[model samples]
Target: MPTLRQQLFRIKPVPRQKEDVETDLKRTIGLFSLTMVGVGSTIGTGIFFILSESVPVAGPAVIWSFVIAGAVAGLAVICYAELAGSVPVSGSSYSYAYATLGELPAMGVAACLLLEYGVAGAAVAVGWSQYVNQLLFNLFGFQIPHALAYAPEEGGIVNLPAILLLAMCCFLLVRGTGESIVVNAIMVCLKIGVLIFFICVGVTGWDSNNFADFAPFGISGVVAGSGLIFFSYVGMDAVATAGDETKNPKKTMPRALIAALIIVTSVYVLVAVAALSAQPWEKFDGQTAGLSAILENIVGSQWPGTVVAAGAVISIFSVTLVSIYGQSRILFTMAGDGMMPKLFREVNPRTLTPVKGTIVVSAVIAVLAGFIPLNFLAEMTSIGTLVAFVVVSLAVIILRVREPNLERGFKVPFYPVLPVVSIIGCFWIISSLQIITIVVFIIWTAFILGLYFIFGRKSSVLGKQLAEAGPTNPESARTDSTGGAK
Candidate 1:
């Protein structure tokens, strides 16, 4: 049996020295394409669908909720950028944690991120089902049978449309990233334009009466609303996940992170304020395709609503694709570390993408999107993301302390204080979540950690290489590990 010390920690250093472990992924993504990846994934389901659900909890105070969530997301991204710029690896916070905190905790971070990306992707696909149905219903005056569109809890036998959507994204990803993110970039532009249109028309319907009871549920509501709305900002870290495929990670990663942060935050705040102004907050409670519903109610015509619904249907598909893409990359890196099946690490020689990993990820996500209740997925996503952000913040501090001279293109402005604040902010929001989300997250993380101790520690490629290398340098170890192969 391994000692407790051995069982709980395995640190992964920067692997550029290891030729055998080099992922060999093509670095074809430039800044604009990378930024669009962030924008594409960040703007999905949350803003498209979270508003109506959040309004009842927050009233017009929901406006503050969007801002609060954006603030925390912004803080967390700073820590992620520092780590991404310094380490420039593929697994995101999962890689960051292994660099700074060691492998046991890296696996823990991996577990949180796996939940964050998977549940969020599933949630987006489920959200996409609603808009797709709305689009079809608007154009033809006929809807698919509910049994084929939603989960059992939502009064359907299975969410078949959502499953089909996930499968479509999987196919696109296997085809390659260049084609995928180009389509995503165009979708990002289209979705933002549609949201701007929402703002334009919604402003005309503003009523002072809606502001009268803005805090009906009080400050508690604002905090609680932030927790719910935080899900909207989940995908910003995905930019960091592209570190390996990015051109000039030191410059491009931070630029894309800040740009996507500003774009997603501004767009979300604008959408929330417009939707709140367009209709009474109470009316938001059950407004399915709520943003479109606001436009229809305002114009007393279905055409404007149909246009918005069509944009949503077409655009959310990209969001689902981008989000799922992030999850596959993270797992791909884990496989490269020998923490998952090696087959997942195999980059397709033709496409330079992890086709096997994408297929496996899409299959698992399809089941979640098709059968699980959407609300459960949303809350679990928010909670797991909070934990992952906390890990990233802590990783920044640990990395700085352990390797002060590490080259960093973008060091966080305030250093230790800001990282601590990032950590505190994540926990504060986490505290406001309902009991069930907290419980489910606890159960899920515990199970993942358990699996790590039982199987992962013995299998880590970096750990085995280091064991064999003793105190020798990484270059010598690399020669032996790969027999000097390119």
Candidate 2:
């Protein structure tokens, strides 16, 4: 066994030579498609369902929560922008960690991403189920049975709609990345258009009286709500996941990351303000499809609500697809790095995509969607993203010192200050999470890390590099198609 210091901080950073990066993925996605991926991924289940949860916690001050969450997300995305400029790969934060932190730290990052994307996919699927039921009811005056529409804890046997949505995404992914991302971009535009519609209609009912006692629960409530809404911003990092497949990554990466972050934050803030102005915050409690509920209550008609529900059905479905795509690709990258099973890394020669990996991810996400409550899964995703953000932020600092002369198409403005603030922001957001959530995240992380020590550590591609190359030095190994330095 290696010494504690060696195990903790061993540097197995990948060589930055172009030939060293093994990739079969096509550089197809342009900046617009990439930006849409971030927007589509970020503006999903959180906005659809979390509003109902956050309003009860922070009342009208939930608008501030959106701003807080956006600021933190922006900080993290800036750090990711700088790193993505330097390391163009598919693993997002996991790839960044491997290239700068080392094998052990990379494993930790892989575990967090798996947890993050997996649960996020499931959470988004669950939210889709709600909107599906809402649309069905609005269209036909009847809805799916409670037992088939919710988790067991919610008095349901299984969430069939969520499972079906996962299956649809799996099919889309197996078709190819080019097709899926284009479809995802189209759906993103539709959703944003609908959100704009909601804001326009909702504002018509705005009364200044609703703003009274905006922060009834005080600063603590705003802070707590920020933690919940942070999940809404979790998927912006999905943009960085496209580095390997993006056209002109160094240029496209930073632009898409910033564009998506700004667009999404603006939408969330606008929607929150409109919704708060529509009615007293107390009315938001116990509301499902919160935005639609607000619209319906104001218009005194079901047509507006029906339109919103229909829009949600489309939007959340796209989100589930995009999120599941991100999850599958991350696992594929890990498998290539030898951190996971080879089955996940295998890309279909016909489609030039990881069909098996996509199926595996969809199946797992389907199970979680069918059984777990959205609330639990959303919390797990937020925690996982928070953990990954901190790692990526730290990696920015590490890479700057280790590779001072590295070419960076997009340098993070403000240098160390931005990255440092990003780290602090992540910790602050995490501090507001429920103690139970923090405990569960700790236990889940330990379980993943434990598996690494037992099996992954010895089997990883980096471990083979250490065995064959004699020593683990910066120049000793080269990264292969499988993402391991050998």
Whole-model Cα lDDT of every candidate shown, in order: 0.82, 0.83
Locate the minimum summed-lDDT window of 10 residues in model 2: 13-22
Task: Tell me the lDDT of model 2 at 202.
Answer: 89
Per-residue C-alpha lDDT of model 1 across residues 1-486, encoded as one tens digit per residue:
335675467566643431123346877788999999888878876777788779999899999998998989899999888887787767888888877787888888888889988988898889888888888888898887999999999889999989999999999999988888788888888888988999999999998888889899999899888988887887788898887788888778888998999999898888888888778889888777788788888999999888888778767788789878888988888877767777778889999999988999999999999999888887777777788899989988888888887778788988898899999999998888889888888788889888776777777776666666666544433321111222
How well is each residue in 150-238 modelled by candidate 2, as lDDT tens digits?
99988899999999999988998899999999899999999899899999998999899999888999999998898888878888889
lDDT of 1 at 142: 87
Off by over 4 Å in 2: 1-9, 18-22, 212-214, 471-476, 480-486
- Looking at candidate 1, the ten consecutive residues that score lowest on lDDT are 477-486
Q: By lDDT, who's the top model here?
A: 2
